[model samples]
Structures are given as C-alpha cells and as structure tokens.
Target chain A: MLGRIEQKVLRGGRLTPEEALALFETDDIHLLGRLADTAAERRSRGRAYFVQNRHINHTNLCLNRCRFCAFSRSKGERGAFELSTEEVLERLEGSPEGLSELHMVGGLHPEWPFEHYLELLRAVKERFPRLGIKAFTAVEVDHFSRISGLSLRETLARLKESGLDLMPGGGAEIFSEGVRKRLCPEKITAERWLEVHRTAHELGIRTNATMLYGHIESYADRVDHMIRLRRLQDDTGGFQAFIPLSYHPFNTEIRGGRPSGIDDLRTIAVSRLVLDNFDHIKAYWVMLGEKLTQVALLFGADDIDGTVVEEKITHAAGALTSEGLTREALIGLIRGAGKVPVERDAFYRELNLYGDRYEDRQGDGAEAPDRFRTARARQ
Target chain B: MRKRLHPEGVVTFVVDRNINYTNVCINRCRFCAYYRGPDSPEAFVLGRDELFRKIEETLEEGGTQILLQGGLHPGLDLSFYLEMLRSIKERFDINIHGFSPPEIHYIAGRANLTVGETLQSLRDAGLDSIPGGGAEILSDRVRQVLSPRKIRSAEWLEVMEEAHRLGMRTTATMMFGSVEGPEDIVEHLDALRGLQDRTGGFTAFIPWSFQPKNTELGETVQDRPLGAGGAEYLRIVAVSRLYLDNFPNIQASWVTQGIKMAQVALRFGANDFGSTMIEENVVRAAGVSYRASRRGIVDAIRSAGFKPAQRDTHYNIIRRL
Candidate 1:
C-alpha cells in the first residue's frame, strides 16, 4: 500500500484520500519521514524559512469562549485585557530593528465594531510601514463582516486597504464538523472559514493555513482537514505556508494532555506529504518548543515560523518555550539542524540567507552582537 | 548484534514503580526539574502510610520491585533512609532497588562514613540493589557545567565501585543531549564499559534523552538542540550496544521517548523496555508525561516482533506473556 503511495508521491502524482490515510496509519515512521523529506526538498531547495516577526494579541476579551482555547477570557475576567490603539503602537515601538513582520490576532471583542480593527491596522501601518502586517484569521474576518453589516469581500477589501498585507491561518482548528461542533461550536463553521480565505485570496491578499491537532481529533479528521485546505489551495494558490498547531492542554476547558513527540512529528510529515499544494510547512517553535522544532526540520518541515517575539496565545496555554527567540537563536536552531537559514518576509521572500557566509556577516553588527559572537564561538 | 545478544528473541521489562520518597534536595542539579528546596511550599517527604500504600498497590498490580529513590534532603540523615528501607522491607516482600551513587555519596558525607560503609549499612537496612539516576554524562568536564554541586565523576564511580565490591548489583544510565559533545558521550560509555569489565556487577545500561522543559538548563541552553532527537537517540542505543560489549543488557527509556520510538529502539539495539512506571513524577515535572501500562508494554514489544517477558531487578524472568 505504501509502495504505490510512495511511487505516486515520488513521481509527482497527487495522493488520494485513502492513500494519505494509509500513510497516517503506517508504523513505518522512518520511511514516512524519508518520503516526506524528499517531497519537502523538492518544494524548498534545502532552505528553511524564518521571519523576524512579532506577535500582538491585542485583546483577550472574547465573546465565543472556545473550549480548546485558554487565551480568551470574559470582559470582566481578572486577566482579560483590551489594548488600546496607543498601547498596541507602544508594544510595537519596543520591537527591534530589521523586524520584517507584525502578526496580529486576537479574540472576537463583542463591543468593538469592525471599524476598530480597521483603525488598529491603519495605525500600525502608518507607524511601521516597513513591517508587513499579517493580521486576523478567517474566523475574525467573518466576524468583522457580520459586525460591519458588509459583505465578506467588502470587509476584506477594507482590511486590505487598511494595510493588512496577509492573513494568518488560525481559527481553522479542524475542518471536520463533528470535531468542530464540540471543539468550538460558537465559532464560524469550516465552510465560512474557507470562504473568508477564498475572498481574501480573490482580493489579491495571500494567507497561510493551519490545522489544530492533538486534541480530540482523529487521524481521519486530520487528513480531512488537510485535504480541504489542499482543495482550496488547488483553486487559489494563496496559502504561503501550512502550520500544524500542536494542541497545548493547560488551563483549558478541554483539559487533555499534550500529544507525544511522535504524534507531533508524524503530523508534520503527513502534512508535508498530503498538502502538496503548500510550498512551505512551518514547525511553529512557539508550540513545538525549540528542540522538537529542530527535529521537525528533518521530518519534512521547511520553516521554523519566526523569532515570534512575545507570543502570548500559546504561552497563555502553558507553553514551555520562551516567549521570544533572538534572531541569533533562530539562526542557531536552523543551523543546528544542518539546514540553511533564510530570513524571510511575511510572504516568505528571501531577505537574508544565513549560509556559509553567515560567520563573516556576524561581524557587521547584526542584532544582539554579543550573543551572535557567542553563537559563532560555539560553532 | 541484537540476534547475537538475544538468541531467544525475547524483550524483557520490569514491572516497577519509581517511588520518589522526598523532593527536598540540597544539591539541585541544573538539568533536574524534580528537586525542590528545603523550605519550598511543595517540598515533601513521603510518610510511612503513603509509602506503604504505594508498595501495597504495586504488589497488588503484580509489580515485583520498587525503584525507591529520592532527592538528598538536607534535613534527613542516614537514619531517615534506614528507617524507610527497613519499614518497607518489614511490610512487603518486594525487592528494594534504591539510591543512586550521588545519594549514597551525599549520605556517606553527612554520616562521616566511607562509600563501602554506606553501602553496607544500606544493604543491612534492606536495599536489594542500586539504580543509576544522577550519572548525567560521567565526565568531569561535562559534570562541572551541569552539576558542580553534586558528586564529582570520581565520587559517583567510587560509590558504584563500592556497591559492586559489596556484591550489590546496580544499573548505569546516561542522560545525554544536554551541554555534552560526542566526545563526552564516548567518555561516558567508555567509563561504563571499563567499570563493567572490572566488576561485572552492572546489570544494564540505560541511555535516556535529557528532557529540558522546566529545567534551568533548558533556559540557558537556547541556541542548540535542547535534547537529542529520535534519530540521535537510536544512534546512541546502537552505539552503546556495539561499544559496551561486556554489558549484558540495554534499556530503552519510554519515559522520555514515547512508546513508538521505544519500539523503534528495539530494532536499533535495545533488548529491554525499561519499566512500566506505574507512577512517575520526575519526567512529569520536566513537562513530559508518558505513561505505559504492563499491557501496553507487552503489546508494544509484541508488535515490534519480540516476545515480551516480565523481569525482576536482577533480570530474572518472573513471568512470560
């Protein structure tokens, strides 16, 4: 069974849903990893991507209290915070130079209208114009459309006009309706999420896609989720990357243990093999931790996400990784995996390739010069 | 090599529970997340009732031995350990495999006795064997960075040698993937092989990866791979199997690596699945919580094409499934 699938994958043929499911159930992890690694090398020519990006989770005062989310809170809750536009700007003010992107996502505020999100995006863009703004999930976009009494296309047009360069693929949890009903019933359905991304793509705004695994979802549900995204990507080549979010189970209404490292790596490998339309598969270090993320690079992941300065969402759910990683640390992690570290923008355009010439470039006053020096000495 | 080592095509595991008697420690190693200070709100020493209850449960569940270990509490003397061991022995007829070298060395220093004297006293108090807990890298160069306050390499080896000379068997372990290079790992294996050649009292060699979730070392070592990966783990298992020719057994740590990777390790070189670990808190404190029942271990071994057997502390087959 795997032989036929391997031949199809190696020969650049699309995998049927049954074949992908078989790949998921197979215990031959080494062969699965090897095939996925070959597929990844074909897509990305040995260059792993990272961005000098910062995350701004503006508010946690959410209306739809998803059972799987520990980051959201009620309005009067003790830890619920709503950052004003000035506070958001102030948070970005502390960001280091050479920062290429600002990833902003938050809970659905019940009171704030859609204009508030537009104003926030415009304010961030007017201040840090060079930082590409990757803001909002498809779920948030649908909420914006409903709040503003506008169509989905109109709402996305206003957001794009307000300097939203890209959309992060969050809130897509699992596309299977059975799991979605229990996971986050109040949130938008899978069809609406896909519609929001499709409209965003039609309006010339690229985005990424994600699937939240390691919760109550099954292997079949995961394969279904990826196939849905692959079908969408097949129509609109808009997804720049596909991220498999490892479900961190801490302080959530659905309190389950985190998945094993084997499950995490297998999900990454299967996503790379199944999501053939996606050019990049990100091992988001904020959730996977640095060590597992390094191993994921060998298991068919081509991106380590980014430096992820001040990632509050996963940390709010008891992520053990640091809130942020220095640029030198990201480089060290990628290099330690024996891959070329290519610093990319929000759209994954190569901004700086830290290859063999990285040592010489370290002396030219990169960020955290002392730390970079120490990293060099260690190498 | 695997076939030559095990001609009967059997993989063995011990049905034991790691009972940490106390959490208070003075020599808090950086890579350890299980130790607590003397005055911390979470510091605790198991009472006699709780210890006996745990042993009774283990015995009820067909567990043959108790891997009794603990942190070196500053307030507890040798009498505390002696009482704990003697009380358990008086209550239950189970094998008591307790105390790594660092704990023995610390107890010896506190009581002003030699290593041999400490082993003799513990044996007299009903310690059946010793476990290898605190031997992180077995190189002074690496030990200085990881655990300077703990026992030195020579002291750890001296305590193990003393136990062997006392006719008490012990296991050896290596916690790699933390601030150590390949040379350091080689040095650790070389030290274990040399000792096994001399004494032949070392029962098995277990190499588990260093899980760096809640440890201070995880915070400091941010630039490199925090711990060894699955491939590196398999490489270490294969190398240890080939290098330590005098050692009789190699254990795959499912506590650190999950069941799937542990099954893969059986193909690499491991002849034993380490333990069922009905209760494990040390790795849980490190943010990795992997649990396996005896049925799960047996199933994993059978699926990996090896016969599963339950063994005691001395690797004697107590039952075959």
Candidate 2:
C-alpha cells in the first residue's frame, strides 16, 4: 500500500487522502521520510529556511477560552497581559540586529476593539519599517470581523492596509468539527478559519496554514485539514507554508501528553507529501525543540520558523526548548542536519545562503564538531 | 548480516518489567531524568511491599524476569541490595537481572570492595545478570561532559568485564544523540567490541536514542542536542550489528523509538525486540512513554514478517508465539 503511494509521490503525483492516511499508518518510516525529503528538495533544493523573527503575543486576555489553549487567559486572570503599542515597539527595538520579520499573534481580547489591532500593526510598522509583520491567524481575523462590525474581507483589508505583511498559522487546531468542538468550541469553526485565509489570499495576502496534532484529532482529520488547505492553495496560490504544530501538554485544560518523535516526524513528512501545492513546510522549533527540528529537516520540513525571540504560547503549554535561537545556532542546526542554511524573510525569500564554506570561514570557536559530516567522511 | 546471524527467521524479545528500585542517586548525570536528589520530596526508595507487588504483577503477566535497576542512592549499601535480592529470590521463582555497572561500581565503592567482589557478591545474592544502563557513550571526553560524577569509561568497562569474568553475562548499551560526536560513538563501539573480544560476556547490544525532554543536559545543550532521529537510530543499530562482531544479539529499543521504528529496525540488523517493559520510569521521566503488551509485541513482530519468541535473560527462548 505504501509502495504505491511512494511511487506516486516519487512521480510528482498528488496523494489521495486515503494514500496519505496509509502513509501515516505504514511502518516504512524511512521510505516515508525519504519521499518527503525528495519532495522538499524538488521545491527548495538543498536549502533550509529560517527567519530572523521575533514573536510578540500582544495579549493573553482572550474571549474564547479554548480548551487546548494554555496561552489564552480570561479577563483579569492572574497571568493575563495586554501589550500596549509602546511596549510592542520597545520589545521590537530590543532586538534589531538582523531582525527581518515580526511574528505577532495573540488571543482575541474581549474588550479590545479591532482598531487596537490595526493601530498596533501600524505602530510596529512605523517603528520597524524594515521588519515584515506576519500577524494574526484566521481565527483572529474572524474575531476582528465580528468585533469591527465589518465583513471578513474588510477586516483583513483594513489589517493589511495597516501593515500586516502576512498571516500566521494558528487557531486552525484541527479542522474536524467533532474534535474542534471538543478542543475549541468557542473559537471559530473550520469553515470560518479557511474562509478567512481564503479571503486573505484573494486580497493578495499570503498566509501559512497549521494543524495542531497529538491532540484528539484522528489521522483522517489531519488529512482532511491538509487537503482543505491544499484546495485553497490550488484556488488562490497564496498559502506560503504548512506547519504541523505538535500539541504540548503542560498547563492546559486538555492534559494529554505530548506527541512522540515518530508522530511529529510522520505528521511533517505526511504534510509534505500531501500538501504538494504548499511550497514550504515549517518545523516550528519552539515546540519541536532543536534536535527534532533538525531531524524534521530530513522528514520534509524545509523551514524551522525563525529565531522566535520569546515564544510564549508553546512555553505556556510546557515546551522544553529555548524561547529564542540565535542566527548562528539556527545555522548550526541546519548545517548539523547536513543541509545548507538559507536565512529567509517572512515570505521565505533567501536573505543569506550559508554554504559549506560559510562555517569554516567564520571559524567560530563555539562550533561543535560536525558529527554528521565526520560520519559521512568516515563512510 | 541479520540473515547471516539469525538464519532461523525469528525475532526474540524478553518479557520483563524494568523496576526502578530507587530514584535517589548521588551521580546525577546531566543527561539523566530518572534520578532525583536525596532531599527532593519526590525522591523515593521503593518499599519492600511496593517492590514485591511489582514483581508479583510481572510474574502474573508471564514475565520471566525483572530488569531491576535503580539510581545510585547515597544511603544504600551492598547489604541493602543483597537483602532485597535475597528476599525476592526467596519469594519468587524468577530471574533478577539487576544492577547496571554504575550502580555496581557505586555499591562496591561504598562497601570498599573490588568490582569483581561486588559482582560476585551480587551474583551470589540472586542478581541473575547485569543490565547495561550507565554506559551512555564510552568516551571519557563525552563522559566528562555528560556524567562527570559517574564512573569513567574504563571503570564502566571494567565493571562489565569483572561481571563477565565472574561468569555473569551482561548486556551492552549506548545512549547516543546527546553531546557526543560520531567519533565518540565509534569509540564507544570500539570499546565494547574490544572488551567482548577478550571476555565474550555481552549477550546483546542495545542502542537507544537520548530523550532530551526534561534533563539538565537537555536544557544546557538547548540549541544543539542531537536527539537522534529514526534514521540515525537505524544507522547506529546497523553499524553496531556490523561492528560488534563478537556480540551475538542486537536489541531494537522500542521503548525509545516507537513500535514502527523498532519493526523497521528488524531489517536494520536488530535481532531482538528489547522488552515488554511492563513498567518503565527512566525514559518516562525524560517525557517519552511508549507502552506495549506481550500480545502487542508479538503482533508487531509477526506483522513485520518475523516469528516472535519470548526469551529469558540469557537469550534462551522459552516460548515461540
């Protein structure tokens, strides 16, 4: 069964939902990873992408207290926080060195009007004009539409006009309604999330899609979610990346354990094979940790999703990785996985390419000995 | 190589539970998540009742042996281990494969005895075999960084050699994907192969990946810890099978890798599915939990196109499933 899927994937053919599920169930993990690697290579060659970005979760005071969310907090909750426009600028100003992108997402604040989000985006853009702002999710966009008394298109258009360069992929936890009801019933539905992204794409705003796995969602649910995103990409061609968010079970209402490494890699590999229309697949290092992110490179993830200077959402849910990674550390991770590191902006355009000689020429004393290189040399 | 080594077309596994006798350890290795400081509220040395209950459950589940291992408790001496072992042997007719090299080394030091004396005493007191738990990577360069408080590479090898010399066969293990280089891995394999060449005491070689979820090492090497992927695991298992010519068996660590990866490892030169692990706390403390029943393991092996057999501690098959 997996053989047929492998042949199809090798021939640059799209995988059926059934085929994708079969790949998920197959014990031939090496083959699945190899096929995903091949597909990723076809898209991005040997280049692995990361953005020098900072994550500013503007507020944690949320209206929709999703069950799976550990980041969201109710009004006046103990840890609830809402960053002012000045504070957001101060945070961005703290790290301007090689910072090309600002990844801003937060909860749907119950009291904050839609103008507050627009103003925050404008203020951030005015302060750091060079930094591309990839802000908000489809769920957030839907919330803005409801809060602003405007249509979805108008809400996205207003935000885009106020300097939102791209949209992040969150809140699309799992598209399966049965699971989504259990996970985030108060949050936007699957159709509403996709509609927001579809409307954003139609307005020339490229966005990323995500699926939060290792929760209650089934394999069929994941395949359905990816196919839906693929269909949207086929129509609008504006989906920039696909990130499979591994569910972290820490301070949350839903207290399932974290996903195993095999499940994480399988989701990444299967996403690569299934989402053929999506150009980039990200292994979000904040949730995956540094090591599995490197392995995910082999499993078809091309992007490690930026420096992410203070990732709060996953950390609130019990992520063990550092909040942020340095550029050198990112390069080391990519190169350690035996791939070329391509520093990218939010849109994944290559800002700098660190080839094999880049590290040797730099001669950084802190560099660990490249064991993969040594192992290959020995072979 | 697998075909050459096991022409019988059978994959063997030991149905046993790893009972962590205690969580209190002096040698709190940076890479270890199982050990707790003596003063910690969670620190515990299992009471006799709890230990007996675990053993009784293992026996009820058709487990032929108990992989009894624990942390190097500062307060526990050789007499404590001896008494525990004698009591278990007196009650249950089951093999007690307890005490890794580090624990043995620590117990010997506490009692002011040689490694040979320690192994002989423990063997005499119902320790059926030694498990390979402490040999993370047999390179002092890596060992000094990972486990400076624990025994050095030579001491780990010496303990295993002494156990072998005392006619007690032991298993060999390598916990890769930590801070070690590939040369360190090769060095580890070389040490095991060289020792096996002299004593021929190792019954099997088990190589598992380092789970870096909740350990001090995981936080220290936060950016660049190589939590080795499945391919890296397969490569290591295949290389171990090819390199460790003197060793007879290679175990697929389904506890670390999931069952699918372990099944794939059968073709990658692993002959044994490690253990059922009716209860495993060490790896779970590191935030990875993979459970498999005897029937689940048997079905996995069968689906992977190999016959499954239940084996005792000495690699002797007791039943073919």
What local distance difference test score does each model get?
A: 0.87, 0.85
* Model 2 pairs whose backbones collide: none
- Compute each candidate's TM-score over C-alphas: 0.79, 0.75
Best by DockQ: 1
**For residues A127-152, what per-residue lDDT tens digits would candidate 1 score against the true structure?**
99888999999888988888899999
Quality class of the docking in candidate 1, CAPRI style: incorrect
List fnat per candidate, in order.
0.11, 0.07
Q: lDDT per residue, candidate 1, B162-193, as tens digits?
A: 89999999999999989899999999999988
Q: Tell me, by TM-score, which candidate is best.
A: 1
The residue pairs that clash in candidate 1, if any, are none
The TM-score measured for candidate 1 stands at: 0.79
The candidate maximizing lDDT is 1
